[model samples]
Target chain A: MSFHDREFKKPDFNRISDVIWEVPTSFKQGMRVPAQVFTTKKLLGEMDAHVFDQITNVATLPGIVRAAMCMPDGHSGYGFPIGGVAAMDIENGGVISPGGIGFDINCGMRLLRTDLTWKDVEPKLKQLVNLLYDRVPAGVGSAAFDDAAGFAKLSHGQFREMISSGAEWCVEKGYGWKEDLAVTEEEGNAEGADESRVSDKAVKRGLGQVGTLGSGNHYLEIQVVKKENIFDEEYAKKLGIFPGQVVVMFHCGSRGFGHQVATDYLQLFLSVMESKYGIKILDRELACAPFTSKEGQDYFAAMKCGINFSFANRQMIAHRIREAFAQIFGKDAEALGMRQIYDVAHNTAKLEEYEVDGKKKKLLIHRKGATRSLGPGNPNIPKAYRDIGQPVIIGGSMETGSYLLVGTKGAEEQTFGSTAHGAGRTMSRTRAIREIVGNTRDMPRDKARAIERRKVEELVINPMIKKGIYVKSVSYSGLAEEAGFAYKDIDEVIDATAKADISKPVVRLIPVGNVKG
Target chain B: MTMSYHFVEDVSLADVAFEASGKDLKELFESAGLAVTNTMVRNLASVHTKVTKTVDVEGSDVENLMFNFLQEFVFLKDAERLLFGKIKIDEISEIACKATLYGEKLDSKRHDLSVDVKAITYHMFRVERTREGWQAFVVLDV
Candidate 1:
């Protein structure tokens, strides 16, 4: 049934705590387990009805272990709502669905801390932003490296090695510092990546798109660690963040490569979902296969390749950002103290061991639009930051500020070590466009103005400019759509995250410059 | 034959969706292609035939064919940087179709690029024949 026609009662949420809400299994027919949602009472009221429907649909998937969970930033997505998290038991017919990982596989955030302060960069904001906008190829159909010239030089075997090696390959090629690898999630390489499983079309799409910042919420921002916003001063200092300290953050993914890999596998899963697996799904986007099956194994291998591609993609971009800083600040990247704090992937289905029912069990956890927030003493964290737990970068809209947080043990017990990814969208892109530009779908060609080139800036851009944040983008319409008003309030979302004890806020950053695609 | 298509509001806060219909499969495919193109560029009339590419895709069923057909345009846009203003489906069947696409390389100066559609999603994706015509609903990942 369509969403409009479907009948749903206000889900009976059992208040597990002040911030934790649970929809018991009785809420839906096919649900094998309950659904856990983390949000404040007010934020929960703000969610659309479809968010509950989509999360309940996820609860019905085969082999789900505990409950289908959503983070504070949860919103309706295609098959699975964004900010969804669920773990499946491999032995109990657990399945792998591309919808769980999202189209942009390994789409994630990376943060870099620098010794420079906001005062140092504010004077040259325009030049620095323009330089970054130029150096990093962005927007639709933008490619930084020409594939024919670059990949053509490498033999097929060498290209395979690069894909298999992930960020290490980029480091070996001198794209990043060797130390950067340790701070990256999974050490920048996911195991079991077999390039042979990756389709040629996916490979072709990936060739030259490395280091490109893609459109639609993907961006690079120069931010300042605001002293007044720091909630945990000791922890913030331990992370090398301080008042007025300058930092860089960017959000991106595997680009066309990841999209194609997800597309290829979704098609395969759809073709066999009923015949080989005997599984039924509520939505076509939820197509999946048993995790141990050949189809699932193949997708996992190819998905690893996508994950590797993303790691390499961010590594390359990090190198570029460093160069841009060095060029503008008149100091080498090292002397500028531009070191990586951590990198985390929001869209991924990883096989990990977690304790369930006081027994350690292997589960394939799918986190879409959610970040892994592993608590302190987790051996997986880099040795340097193990005492403070993994750093979770929660990016806000260009106009709102972002936050740096630390994982909590409570999250590991409550939600598979996952937390909110960002300030989720509150309005659809069409609605955002309609708000900025008058109706043009029915207008004549001559009457249709280029909203991107319109001289009059929207109300959103004005405030950002007044705040001394320089914004550069390929399209003003795109910029308007991503305005802070279009998304949930970052402060409220983080407040829910902290109150829920999934993650604790360390520092808040105000944007000084933003480069949008 | 009359062909029609219109953008529809999806529940997704980040993506876009559309509904397209035509008298038959050929017209339906063409209308869907146009709808997808319109999401990227501001004005379809402004895009000229500076480049032409043939897209040949095959699938096991009509639904798969629609998925592949729409995905081909996304691939072409990123791989070759071409944005088609016009699409002509020369051949079509339940399993396969061959089409010619006409457009120009994406130019920021000339083309007002809107949403960057990352990929086509199968969320609520449908292709069916009604008494009035063939209709399809598509959700795009932006």
Candidate 2:
């Protein structure tokens, strides 16, 4: 059989509506619902077999509602698959699975707008980039205070406070401005967080590392606007953006705290799930427990801790950036218009009300490698952005362009207020190192990198990695994934969504410089 | 003299019944903290801090003591901008001890910020002994 056929059989691309395609449950056993993948021929060609399997696996989970939907950047991941979205009803025996949340918990991204444009600070770009890089900790176990950020940092008391307070803790400690909290996702914290549920190891890992940026696909980038006026310039100006102006965008998350949360739950669920609920998982990574169960409550509470810690982290980084800017410019960052635009979590599971069967129902939505792209006038949205809707920050690679997009009403009918996070890797990191890295054909890692070796070296040192790495000898049909060249051109993926009218672009950002650990 | 160090991929988890062997509980806790820091960055000598902050941590037992020590690293890294450098064992006891670790504010131009350790995990995590002194595997979650 063709490698694709063995893994995916035939793609049941039955376009159910204008945008949704249904892969019926008959395609795979144990599927509670059908998979609704949002893509076209153009986008489908860019996806791999594993992504198909991931979508299928998600549909089979207990208490899953609607369709096991995937965004445009869908790729093979642990249980839920990156770019995959599924909603489970809490009252209907809905199960909370670690695979749904992934190991990163609330892995997310944020964009900060500054009054000073590239033209205003072009002369001082060198100083700004260097300073930001120096202050923020990066790479593995790269906690802010600890030499080795691990489970030890979280401990008992500190871990409890972080989960309960969310970003308020950081604000109380003066790491960020009080006003900054208004524009953040969930007001920079989740209310349901109960630290009592988190394990001792998870607590120690999180306690002091709340504000640090860890490595492996996590980064801080200093980028420049590639093009403007894709939308109204007046709005862009209001967002503190100008053509050729410099902007800072960062991608990091709850660090080891979240990883431990998902890891601990994955292991716990593995042992208790089948025995307690008679649930059989399609993938070990997809281990789950009923939402009403003790295990589920504990995981949710602990996951909230990770979510809040991430908000605290980004908040801290923002404060430090403001300080650095003030030190150099001799002016307060706020006075200079350096404030947060919006912060969004990409990988997470949340309770949200979306229309189902022409009625609004509350469901737990798990979006891995997908950002919530809520539209305007929703009570959940901050009042300031009510006119324009929530700003969706999509982070591309260091070499490619990141985007600022606004959610549309059309997306509500299509996606559950969600959009792709980035150029989902077609190739695993190991494959990238072996095939794409050090290769002449690969694009420059970034404009500021003196040599490409530094980026490649980091990839080599990346630890705590996971990949199925299917063997051809065992299956004769596993050929599509390798790394870099495997993904479709990211710009094209964005354009496809644009054509579908899912999200309209505001600005495209190309990385001028970046540091990846 | 600078020395070439081998890359210990999974240092936090040992292969065998490799646990730290210290005569006293204080020694065991101290060794646990040391084991964790050494596993993360390349070497302690490469890190230094002119700024000094005192860490006074006490937990009920050996396991909790290790927990407090890990929390200390997190506190110092975020608020003080100090990454752990070296461990100076001043006093050791069943419930508490004093250790002075060396670190400085993060300087990108001057020093490399090696890794953003999210937290340490207890997967195969333990304090153990080596022939030279005391050693333990501290599995770090990167």
For model 2, the DockQ equals: 0.10
Quote the true-contact fraction of every model.
Answer: 0.65, 0.18
> Relative to the true structure, how large is the alpha-carbon lDDT of every model?
0.87, 0.64
Q: Which stretches of candidate 1 lie over 4 Å from their true place?
A: A1-9, A145-159, A444-447, A450-456
Local accuracy of candidate 2 as per-residue lDDT tens digits, B1-142: 1111122321111110113435444455555554444333324444676765566777565444555566567445534456666556677654576777766765543433334444443333443334443334333443
In candidate 2, which residue ranges exceed 4 Å CA deviation? A1-10, A17-19, A145-159, A226-229, A436-487, B1-142
By lDDT, who's the top model here?
1
Pairs in clash, predicted candidate 1: none
Q: Can you write out model 2's per-residue Cα lDDT over A3-40, one digit (the tens) per residue?
A: 11133554767877555678888888788888987766
| Weakest lDDT window of 10 consecutive positions for candidate 1 chain A | A145-154
